[model samples]
Target: MKLYIVRHGQTEWNVEKRMQGWGDSPLTQTGIRDAGLLRERIKEVPFDEAWASPLKRAEQTADILVPDQQIHVHEGLKEMRLGSMEGKRQEDLHPSEKKTWQTFWEDPERFQPNGGETYGEVEKRVNGFLEDISRTSSGNVLLVTHTVVIKLLINRFEDRPLRRIWEPPYVHETCLTIVDWDGTNGKIEVSCSIDHTKAGRGW
Candidate 1:
Protein backbone atom coordinates (compact mmCIF):
# COMPACT_ATOMS: atom_id res chain seq x y z
CA MET A 1 0.00 0.00 0.00
CA LYS A 2 1.09 3.53 -0.77
CA LEU A 3 0.40 6.34 1.70
CA TYR A 4 0.35 10.08 1.16
CA ILE A 5 0.54 11.84 4.50
CA VAL A 6 -0.01 15.59 4.78
CA ARG A 7 0.26 17.86 7.78
CA HIS A 8 -2.61 20.31 8.11
CA GLY A 9 -2.10 23.86 6.86
CA GLN A 10 -1.21 26.85 8.98
CA THR A 11 -3.74 28.19 11.47
CA GLU A 12 -4.16 31.41 13.44
CA TRP A 13 -2.57 29.64 16.39
CA ASN A 14 0.32 28.52 14.19
CA VAL A 15 1.07 32.11 13.23
CA GLU A 16 0.87 33.20 16.87
CA LYS A 17 3.08 30.30 17.99
CA ARG A 18 0.53 28.92 20.41
CA MET A 19 0.07 25.36 21.61
CA GLN A 20 -2.80 23.92 19.52
CA GLY A 21 -3.02 20.35 20.65
CA TRP A 22 -6.67 19.28 20.89
CA GLY A 23 -7.64 22.95 20.51
CA ASP A 24 -8.16 24.47 17.07
CA SER A 25 -7.84 27.64 15.01
CA PRO A 26 -9.03 28.43 11.53
CA LEU A 27 -6.66 28.27 8.57
CA THR A 28 -4.94 31.45 7.46
CA GLN A 29 -5.22 32.71 3.88
CA THR A 30 -1.71 31.45 3.23
CA GLY A 31 -2.84 28.09 4.53
CA ILE A 32 -5.67 27.92 2.02
CA ARG A 33 -3.35 28.89 -0.80
CA ASP A 34 -0.83 26.25 0.26
CA ALA A 35 -3.53 23.63 0.40
CA GLY A 36 -4.61 24.56 -3.09
CA LEU A 37 -1.06 24.31 -4.29
CA LEU A 38 -0.70 20.92 -2.60
CA ARG A 39 -3.89 19.75 -4.29
CA GLU A 40 -2.45 20.57 -7.66
CA ARG A 41 0.76 18.78 -6.81
CA ILE A 42 -0.90 15.47 -5.84
CA LYS A 43 -4.00 15.57 -8.04
CA GLU A 44 -2.94 12.71 -10.24
CA VAL A 45 -2.34 10.15 -7.50
CA PRO A 46 -5.79 8.47 -7.79
CA PHE A 47 -6.14 7.66 -4.13
CA ASP A 48 -8.54 4.84 -3.27
CA GLU A 49 -9.06 5.82 0.35
CA ALA A 50 -8.68 8.89 2.54
CA TRP A 51 -8.63 9.59 6.27
CA ALA A 52 -8.21 12.68 8.40
CA SER A 53 -8.27 13.80 11.97
CA PRO A 54 -11.61 14.91 13.36
CA LEU A 55 -10.28 18.44 13.86
CA LYS A 56 -11.66 20.97 11.43
CA ARG A 57 -8.28 22.18 10.24
CA ALA A 58 -7.26 18.70 9.13
CA GLU A 59 -10.72 17.92 7.75
CA GLN A 60 -10.74 21.10 5.72
CA THR A 61 -7.30 20.35 4.34
CA ALA A 62 -8.33 16.83 3.39
CA ASP A 63 -11.40 18.15 1.61
CA ILE A 64 -9.31 20.54 -0.43
CA LEU A 65 -6.74 17.92 -1.28
CA VAL A 66 -9.20 15.15 -2.19
CA PRO A 67 -12.32 16.99 -3.30
CA ASP A 68 -14.56 14.13 -4.45
CA GLN A 69 -13.37 11.42 -2.08
CA GLN A 70 -15.05 10.51 1.17
CA ILE A 71 -12.66 11.24 4.01
CA HIS A 72 -13.11 9.05 7.05
CA VAL A 73 -12.57 10.90 10.30
CA HIS A 74 -10.48 8.95 12.80
CA GLU A 75 -10.14 10.04 16.40
CA GLY A 76 -6.86 8.19 16.50
CA LEU A 77 -5.47 10.77 14.10
CA LYS A 78 -6.21 13.75 16.38
CA GLU A 79 -3.37 15.86 17.72
CA MET A 80 -1.95 15.13 21.17
CA ARG A 81 -3.96 16.66 23.99
CA LEU A 82 -1.92 19.45 25.55
CA GLY A 83 -4.03 19.64 28.72
CA SER A 84 -3.28 22.84 30.69
CA MET A 85 -0.86 24.02 28.00
CA GLU A 86 -3.46 24.28 25.28
CA GLY A 87 -3.83 27.78 23.82
CA LYS A 88 -0.79 29.03 25.70
CA ARG A 89 2.31 30.39 23.97
CA GLN A 90 5.68 28.89 24.71
CA GLU A 91 6.73 32.18 26.22
CA ASP A 92 3.79 32.00 28.61
CA LEU A 93 5.02 28.82 30.24
CA HIS A 94 6.75 29.11 33.58
CA PRO A 95 10.53 28.75 33.50
CA SER A 96 10.45 25.30 35.05
CA GLU A 97 7.51 24.19 32.98
CA LYS A 98 9.21 25.47 29.88
CA LYS A 99 12.25 23.36 30.55
CA THR A 100 10.11 20.29 31.05
CA TRP A 101 8.16 21.09 27.91
CA GLN A 102 11.36 21.27 25.91
CA THR A 103 12.47 18.00 27.43
CA PHE A 104 9.12 16.42 26.64
CA TRP A 105 9.62 17.03 22.95
CA GLU A 106 13.16 15.70 23.08
CA ASP A 107 12.26 12.71 25.20
CA PRO A 108 8.52 12.30 24.95
CA GLU A 109 8.44 8.80 26.39
CA ARG A 110 9.87 10.07 29.66
CA PHE A 111 8.17 13.43 30.11
CA GLN A 112 4.73 14.88 29.50
CA PRO A 113 2.56 17.73 30.67
CA ASN A 114 0.46 17.33 33.80
CA GLY A 115 -2.65 16.36 31.86
CA GLY A 116 -1.39 15.66 28.36
CA GLU A 117 -1.21 12.29 26.69
CA THR A 118 2.17 10.60 26.79
CA TYR A 119 4.11 9.67 23.69
CA GLY A 120 3.46 6.01 24.32
CA GLU A 121 -0.29 6.63 24.39
CA VAL A 122 -0.27 8.54 21.12
CA GLU A 123 1.92 5.88 19.57
CA LYS A 124 -0.45 3.11 20.55
CA ARG A 125 -3.51 4.79 19.06
CA VAL A 126 -1.72 5.81 15.89
CA ASN A 127 -0.27 2.35 15.49
CA GLY A 128 -3.71 0.83 15.87
CA PHE A 129 -5.10 3.17 13.24
CA LEU A 130 -2.28 2.30 10.87
CA GLU A 131 -2.78 -1.40 11.40
CA ASP A 132 -6.46 -1.10 10.61
CA ILE A 133 -5.78 0.87 7.49
CA SER A 134 -3.20 -1.58 6.30
CA ARG A 135 -5.60 -4.44 6.82
CA THR A 136 -8.63 -2.80 5.21
CA SER A 137 -7.18 -0.77 2.37
CA SER A 138 -5.45 -2.20 -0.65
CA GLY A 139 -4.58 0.85 -2.75
CA ASN A 140 -3.28 4.34 -2.30
CA VAL A 141 -4.35 6.15 0.91
CA LEU A 142 -4.17 9.79 1.89
CA LEU A 143 -4.08 10.91 5.53
CA VAL A 144 -4.39 14.52 6.65
CA THR A 145 -3.24 14.92 10.25
CA HIS A 146 -1.30 17.06 12.71
CA THR A 147 2.44 17.74 12.90
CA VAL A 148 3.11 15.54 15.92
CA VAL A 149 1.09 12.68 14.51
CA ILE A 150 2.99 12.91 11.25
CA LYS A 151 6.24 12.92 13.15
CA LEU A 152 5.22 9.81 15.09
CA LEU A 153 4.21 8.04 11.89
CA ILE A 154 7.52 8.79 10.24
CA ASN A 155 9.39 7.74 13.34
CA ARG A 156 7.63 4.39 13.35
CA PHE A 157 8.31 3.74 9.66
CA GLU A 158 11.93 4.79 9.95
CA ASP A 159 12.64 2.66 13.06
CA ARG A 160 13.83 5.68 15.02
CA PRO A 161 13.64 5.86 18.80
CA LEU A 162 11.02 7.98 20.55
CA ARG A 163 13.72 10.07 22.22
CA ARG A 164 14.56 11.60 18.86
CA ILE A 165 11.03 12.85 18.29
CA TRP A 166 12.27 16.40 17.87
CA GLU A 167 15.08 15.46 15.51
CA PRO A 168 15.63 16.61 11.93
CA PRO A 169 13.42 16.08 8.85
CA TYR A 170 10.71 18.40 10.00
CA VAL A 171 7.11 18.14 8.90
CA HIS A 172 6.12 21.44 7.32
CA GLU A 173 2.57 22.69 6.98
CA THR A 174 0.76 21.19 3.99
CA CYS A 175 3.87 19.30 2.99
CA LEU A 176 3.60 15.82 1.50
CA THR A 177 5.34 12.67 2.75
CA ILE A 178 4.92 9.45 0.90
CA VAL A 179 5.42 5.94 2.26
CA ASP A 180 5.14 2.59 0.61
CA TRP A 181 4.06 -0.23 2.99
CA ASP A 182 3.95 -3.90 2.29
CA GLY A 183 2.12 -5.48 5.23
CA THR A 184 5.09 -5.87 7.60
CA ASN A 185 7.49 -3.20 6.33
CA GLY A 186 7.37 0.35 5.02
CA LYS A 187 9.70 2.60 3.04
CA ILE A 188 9.77 6.35 2.82
CA GLU A 189 9.65 7.68 -0.73
CA VAL A 190 9.45 11.39 0.13
CA SER A 191 10.10 12.86 3.54
CA CYS A 192 8.63 16.36 3.38
CA SER A 193 8.28 18.33 0.15
CA ILE A 194 7.35 22.03 -0.08
CA ASP A 195 8.02 22.29 -3.80
CA HIS A 196 4.40 23.29 -4.37
CA THR A 197 4.84 26.41 -2.23
CA LYS A 198 7.71 27.98 -4.17
CA ALA A 199 7.89 31.78 -4.39
CA GLY A 200 7.92 32.00 -8.17
CA ARG A 201 5.31 33.90 -10.14
CA GLY A 202 3.31 30.74 -10.76
CA TRP A 203 3.86 28.09 -8.14
Candidate 2:
Protein backbone atom coordinates (compact mmCIF):
# COMPACT_ATOMS: atom_id res chain seq x y z
CA MET A 1 0.00 0.00 0.00
CA LYS A 2 1.16 3.51 -0.78
CA LEU A 3 0.94 6.07 2.01
CA TYR A 4 0.80 9.81 1.45
CA ILE A 5 1.83 11.38 4.72
CA VAL A 6 1.64 15.12 5.20
CA ARG A 7 2.63 17.35 8.12
CA HIS A 8 -0.12 19.69 9.20
CA GLY A 9 0.19 23.33 8.16
CA GLN A 10 1.62 26.16 10.26
CA THR A 11 -0.30 27.32 13.31
CA GLU A 12 -0.25 30.32 15.65
CA TRP A 13 1.98 28.41 18.02
CA ASN A 14 4.30 27.64 15.14
CA VAL A 15 4.75 31.33 14.44
CA GLU A 16 5.47 31.92 18.11
CA LYS A 17 7.92 29.01 18.26
CA ARG A 18 5.94 27.41 21.07
CA MET A 19 5.89 23.75 22.02
CA GLN A 20 2.64 22.53 20.44
CA GLY A 21 2.59 18.90 21.48
CA TRP A 22 -0.92 17.76 22.44
CA GLY A 23 -1.98 21.37 22.77
CA ASP A 24 -4.28 22.76 20.06
CA SER A 25 -4.14 25.86 17.89
CA PRO A 26 -5.88 27.23 14.84
CA LEU A 27 -4.16 27.20 11.46
CA THR A 28 -2.89 30.44 10.07
CA GLN A 29 -4.17 31.72 6.70
CA THR A 30 -0.88 30.69 5.15
CA GLY A 31 -1.48 27.22 6.48
CA ILE A 32 -4.83 26.90 4.73
CA ARG A 33 -3.50 28.33 1.48
CA ASP A 34 -0.53 26.00 1.39
CA ALA A 35 -2.73 22.97 2.02
CA GLY A 36 -4.83 24.08 -0.90
CA LEU A 37 -1.68 24.34 -2.99
CA LEU A 38 -0.76 20.77 -2.06
CA ARG A 39 -4.29 19.62 -2.77
CA GLU A 40 -3.78 20.86 -6.31
CA ARG A 41 -0.40 19.17 -6.53
CA ILE A 42 -1.76 15.73 -5.60
CA LYS A 43 -5.33 16.16 -6.70
CA GLU A 44 -5.12 13.15 -8.98
CA VAL A 45 -3.75 10.58 -6.55
CA PRO A 46 -6.39 7.94 -5.83
CA PHE A 47 -6.54 7.64 -2.05
CA ASP A 48 -8.44 4.62 -0.76
CA GLU A 49 -8.51 5.80 2.83
CA ALA A 50 -7.68 8.90 4.83
CA TRP A 51 -6.47 9.23 8.43
CA ALA A 52 -5.38 12.12 10.63
CA SER A 53 -4.52 13.00 14.18
CA PRO A 54 -7.57 14.10 16.18
CA LEU A 55 -5.94 17.51 16.67
CA LYS A 56 -7.78 20.36 14.99
CA ARG A 57 -4.72 21.52 13.04
CA ALA A 58 -4.26 18.12 11.47
CA GLU A 59 -8.00 17.61 10.97
CA GLN A 60 -8.27 20.93 9.15
CA THR A 61 -5.42 20.03 6.82
CA ALA A 62 -7.02 16.66 6.07
CA ASP A 63 -10.29 18.31 5.23
CA ILE A 64 -8.59 20.71 2.82
CA LEU A 65 -6.51 18.02 1.18
CA VAL A 66 -9.26 15.43 0.81
CA PRO A 67 -12.52 17.27 0.92
CA ASP A 68 -14.60 14.40 -0.45
CA GLN A 69 -13.12 11.63 1.68
CA GLN A 70 -13.93 10.57 5.21
CA ILE A 71 -11.03 11.29 7.55
CA HIS A 72 -10.83 8.73 10.32
CA VAL A 73 -9.28 10.32 13.38
CA HIS A 74 -6.69 8.15 15.10
CA GLU A 75 -5.52 8.75 18.64
CA GLY A 76 -2.31 6.92 17.86
CA LEU A 77 -1.41 9.58 15.34
CA LYS A 78 -1.52 12.49 17.78
CA GLU A 79 1.57 14.59 18.45
CA MET A 80 3.98 13.74 21.25
CA ARG A 81 2.62 15.07 24.52
CA LEU A 82 5.22 17.54 25.86
CA GLY A 83 3.50 17.78 29.22
CA SER A 84 4.88 20.90 30.94
CA MET A 85 6.24 22.39 27.75
CA GLU A 86 2.93 22.33 25.93
CA GLY A 87 2.31 25.91 24.87
CA LYS A 88 5.52 27.44 26.22
CA ARG A 89 7.57 29.52 23.81
CA GLN A 90 11.13 28.47 23.12
CA GLU A 91 12.78 31.67 24.32
CA ASP A 92 10.55 31.92 27.34
CA LEU A 93 11.56 28.61 28.95
CA HIS A 94 13.26 28.98 32.36
CA PRO A 95 17.04 28.55 32.64
CA SER A 96 17.03 24.97 33.88
CA GLU A 97 14.06 24.03 31.72
CA LYS A 98 15.93 25.52 28.79
CA LYS A 99 18.75 23.03 29.24
CA THR A 100 16.36 20.10 29.07
CA TRP A 101 14.70 21.63 26.05
CA GLN A 102 18.06 21.86 24.33
CA THR A 103 18.71 18.24 25.19
CA PHE A 104 15.47 17.32 23.46
CA TRP A 105 16.98 18.48 20.18
CA GLU A 106 20.70 17.81 20.62
CA ASP A 107 20.70 14.45 22.37
CA PRO A 108 17.20 13.16 22.07
CA GLU A 109 18.12 9.79 23.56
CA ARG A 110 19.15 11.42 26.82
CA PHE A 111 16.26 13.85 26.99
CA GLN A 112 14.42 13.53 30.28
CA PRO A 113 11.76 16.17 30.31
CA ASN A 114 10.15 17.51 33.46
CA GLY A 115 6.76 16.37 32.24
CA GLY A 116 7.17 15.75 28.51
CA GLU A 117 7.41 12.33 26.91
CA THR A 118 10.49 10.53 25.63
CA TYR A 119 10.88 9.68 21.97
CA GLY A 120 10.48 5.97 22.70
CA GLU A 121 6.93 6.50 23.94
CA VAL A 122 5.86 8.25 20.75
CA GLU A 123 7.45 5.48 18.67
CA LYS A 124 5.20 2.91 20.29
CA ARG A 125 2.02 4.64 19.19
CA VAL A 126 3.42 5.22 15.70
CA ASN A 127 4.19 1.54 15.38
CA GLY A 128 0.69 0.64 16.50
CA PHE A 129 -0.86 3.01 13.99
CA LEU A 130 1.22 1.64 11.13
CA GLU A 131 0.55 -1.97 12.00
CA ASP A 132 -3.17 -1.38 12.34
CA ILE A 133 -3.39 0.40 9.01
CA SER A 134 -1.16 -2.02 7.11
CA ARG A 135 -3.20 -4.94 8.29
CA THR A 136 -6.56 -3.44 7.36
CA SER A 137 -6.02 -1.04 4.48
CA SER A 138 -4.82 -1.20 0.89
CA GLY A 139 -4.22 1.00 -2.14
CA ASN A 140 -3.34 4.65 -1.47
CA VAL A 141 -3.78 6.10 2.01
CA LEU A 142 -3.50 9.70 3.21
CA LEU A 143 -2.34 10.65 6.70
CA VAL A 144 -2.09 14.10 8.19
CA THR A 145 -0.10 14.52 11.39
CA HIS A 146 2.46 16.65 13.24
CA THR A 147 6.22 17.04 12.74
CA VAL A 148 7.32 14.68 15.50
CA VAL A 149 4.89 11.98 14.46
CA ILE A 150 6.00 12.24 10.82
CA LYS A 151 9.66 12.11 11.86
CA LEU A 152 8.98 9.03 13.98
CA LEU A 153 7.25 7.45 10.99
CA ILE A 154 10.39 8.08 8.94
CA ASN A 155 12.55 6.64 11.71
CA ARG A 156 10.41 3.48 11.61
CA PHE A 157 10.63 3.24 7.82
CA GLU A 158 14.42 3.68 7.87
CA ASP A 159 15.01 1.85 11.13
CA ARG A 160 17.10 4.72 12.44
CA PRO A 161 18.25 4.99 16.03
CA LEU A 162 16.72 7.47 18.46
CA ARG A 163 19.80 9.74 18.44
CA ARG A 164 19.56 10.28 14.68
CA ILE A 165 15.81 10.90 14.56
CA TRP A 166 16.32 14.62 14.07
CA GLU A 167 18.25 14.33 10.84
CA PRO A 168 18.23 16.79 7.96
CA PRO A 169 15.32 17.83 5.76
CA TYR A 170 13.01 19.16 8.40
CA VAL A 171 9.31 18.46 7.87
CA HIS A 172 7.97 21.83 6.77
CA GLU A 173 4.35 22.83 6.98
CA THR A 174 2.19 20.78 4.59
CA CYS A 175 5.24 19.01 3.22
CA LEU A 176 4.36 15.76 1.45
CA THR A 177 6.06 12.45 2.04
CA ILE A 178 5.20 9.30 0.11
CA VAL A 179 6.01 5.82 1.26
CA ASP A 180 5.29 2.33 -0.06
CA TRP A 181 4.35 -0.20 2.61
CA ASP A 182 4.21 -3.88 1.70
CA GLY A 183 2.68 -5.21 4.92
CA THR A 184 6.00 -5.89 6.65
CA ASN A 185 8.25 -3.07 5.46
CA GLY A 186 7.96 0.51 4.31
CA LYS A 187 10.16 2.16 1.67
CA ILE A 188 10.25 5.88 1.27
CA GLU A 189 9.36 7.06 -2.22
CA VAL A 190 9.68 10.70 -1.25
CA SER A 191 11.05 12.51 1.80
CA CYS A 192 9.86 15.90 2.98
CA SER A 193 8.91 17.72 -0.23
CA ILE A 194 7.54 21.25 -0.09
CA ASP A 195 7.42 21.92 -3.81
CA HIS A 196 3.93 23.33 -3.53
CA THR A 197 4.79 25.97 -0.94
CA LYS A 198 5.43 29.65 -1.66
CA ALA A 199 8.84 29.53 0.01
CA GLY A 200 9.71 26.56 -2.17
CA ARG A 201 9.39 28.75 -5.25
CA GLY A 202 12.77 30.48 -4.67
CA TRP A 203 11.13 33.60 -3.34
Show the colliding residue pairs in model 1. none
1-203 per-residue lDDT for model 2 (tens digits): 99999999899999988989999899999899999989998999999999999999999999999999999999889998887888999888889888988888999888777777788888888888988997799999999998889998888889888888899769999999999989778899999999889654555
lDDT (10s digit) by residue, model 1, range 77-108: 99988888889999898787697688776667
Candidate 1: worst-modelled 10 consecutive residues by lDDT: 194-203
Score candidate 2 by TM-score against the native: 0.95
Off by over 4 Å in 1: 199-203
lDDT of 1: 0.88
TM-score per candidate, in order?
0.95, 0.95
Which residue pairs collide in model 2, if any? none
For candidate 1, the clash count comes to 0
